[model samples]
Target: QENRITTVQCLSGTGSLRVGGEFLARHYHQRTIYLPQPTWGNHPKVFGLAGLSVKTYRYYAPATRGLDFQGLLEDLGSAPLGSVVLLHACAH
Candidate 1:
């Protein structure tokens, strides 16, 4: 059995996100992508332009000035099976 993986070097974050979005748009069964509520400003535009439906999952809580952990879990749990989620690992 042969499993093939192809990798492309991306020059920047936005570019990488766009490429990833495009790949998912073509190969993923679920077309909707879940982004964090308080994500980078250009995230929606970049993913949307790459042909994926953009949706938000709870992330930051402005009132508390911290992560909405429970809200995030609930939002993600409610997402359709196989939906793509973009997680920001560090500060954007």
Candidate 2:
């Protein structure tokens, strides 16, 4: 007897992330998706096309041009349970 495993690879990080998000939106009970403010330009459109309502959470602080740690945490903490959140592997 022999055992075998197969794996499939999507394009790259971005492609994989998008595919995963779309899958969740389609199969899971996800209705709303929260994105970081000043995230990649295409993020909102991508999620919207996948049938998930897109919203933004505070991410960057214009005053410092840096990450808004406190605001980000607060927004996440306030979001409804089970809401999908999109995080970037690399800050845009």
Clashing pairs in 1: none
Q: How high is the lDDT of residue 51 in model 2?
A: 78
Candidate 2 segments whose C-alpha is farther than 4 A from its true place: 1-8
Backbone clash total for model 2 is 0
Give per-residue CA lDDT, model 2, range 1-92, as digits (tens): 47988566899766766786778777888688899988777777777777788899998899998889999999999999988887866765
Task: Please report, as a residue range, the 10-residue window in candidate 1 with the lowest summed lDDT.
Answer: 83-92
Give me the overall lDDT of model 1: 0.91
For residues 1-92, write the lDDT of model 1, one tens digit per residue: 58988779998999999999999989888889999988889999998998999999999888888889999999999999888999988733
* Candidate 2: clashing pairs of residues: none
> Which parts of model 1 have CA positions greater than 4 angstroms off?
none
Pick the lDDT winner.
Answer: 1
RMSD of 2: 4.3
